[model samples]
Target: MTLPEQGPLRLLALSPFGAPFDADEPEEVHVALANGEWHGNHLHPDSADDPVNALAIIADAVQETVTACLRQVWPVCAEHGLGMHPRDANGRLSWWCAGERLRRGPAHIRAAVGALDTLMPPRRPNRRSRRAR
Candidate 1:
């Protein structure tokens, strides 16, 4: 999608969430490499006004772009080996994993959306961590 104005979308490119990809114009921005191509619409102006909302929007858009353009899930859960989805976790947008019912714990968050590269070993969700408010 074409954004009437550019905002902090460049921030995504600087994080582990996205890498610098070529755009037709310097004013335009796109997410990570997908088959050497970038996809998805530009972030809306209002979402950029708030960090949390912006992250949620970015995570979803990135996932859509990657899945469609690259034909692959953007980030996969290490423990469950399933593709993760973004959900609000205590005001933070996080990657929620649908863990195995038997061996692994129930559905749990893997990590904050942009923190994949810096993730430590997956930890079981305790009552306290699960009930973030």
Candidate 2:
């Protein structure tokens, strides 16, 4: 995803070698920025067994890393303009917005993780109407 001031943002897996004393220990996998900067706890290896759990874990890690390293919210709700958090909506992992709507309650799911682009309106080129011309 592209940030207006930061250019494009890319996330990558970073697995460093385990401690020298424990050569057999598995490497801990972390979500890192393109430049190799990351923050927060490393992803739990057990989470990899479940796709839904894995997505939730990764989303949380990404949010933590982005907020700390970039000093900004990673994904903001389009309608409410508020920062959204990763949450479990039913059985799916989704981005949850805390902003309320007219009788819509206090919170709602904006979109599934990695599907925020679907909520964004399509970009249209500027074109003057015939009347204006």
- Tens-place lDDT digits, model 2, residues 41-77: 8888899899999999888888888899989897888
lDDT, each prediction: 0.65, 0.77
Relative to the unseen true structure, what is the C-alpha lDDT of residue 24 in candidate 1, on a scale of 0 to 100?
A: 41
Candidate 1 per-residue lDDT, tens place, 7-92, comes to 12232342224545545423333454423355677666567689988878877777776677657775788788899988999988
Model 1 CA deviation exceeding 4 Å by range? 1-29, 32-36, 102-104, 120-133
* Model 1 TM: 0.62
Which pairs clash in model 2? none
RMSD of 2: 5.2
Scanning candidate 1 in windows of ten residues, the lowest lDDT window is: 1-10
